[model samples]
Target: MLSTKCPNACIRACHLPAWQKAEEDVKSLLKEKLLPALQRASLKAERARIHNVIGQISGE
Candidate 1:
């Protein structure tokens, strides 16, 4: 969940021309944005795994 209290510096850093100009900016963007999205996805995957394990244990 993105914090309601904005990280203005991070947000600014993400938007800077220098940040955009960096060769690794795409990777940086991914690290800044997609990483959290991936983490959330991983959490969901783990939850599903746990649910499946419980279901199997319960013979469901």
Candidate 2:
């Protein structure tokens, strides 16, 4: 389904299959729009996980 809303809105509102079958342009734009936010959110969690592992390895 073509998103009448913008990329960010589509990401929040669309279901998985609808997003998967979106037009190439929509997917591309969504990547551009959301990639940074995804990285920001993911990086913090990953960093904390790595810290936990390092502490475990060092017997901290």
lDDT of 1 by residue, 1-60 (tens): 111134542322233344234424443444554467766566556555444433443342
Name every residue pair that clashes in candidate 2: none
CA lDDT of every candidate: 0.42, 0.43
Tens digits of per-residue lDDT for model 2, 1-60? 222225543222224444333333343454554568777566555545444433343342
lDDT for model 1, on a 0 to 1 scale? 0.42
Name the TM-score of candidate 2.
0.38
TM-score, cand. 1: 0.39
Candidate 2 ranges with C-alpha deviation above 4 Å: 1-35
Error of 1 at 57 (Å): 0.4
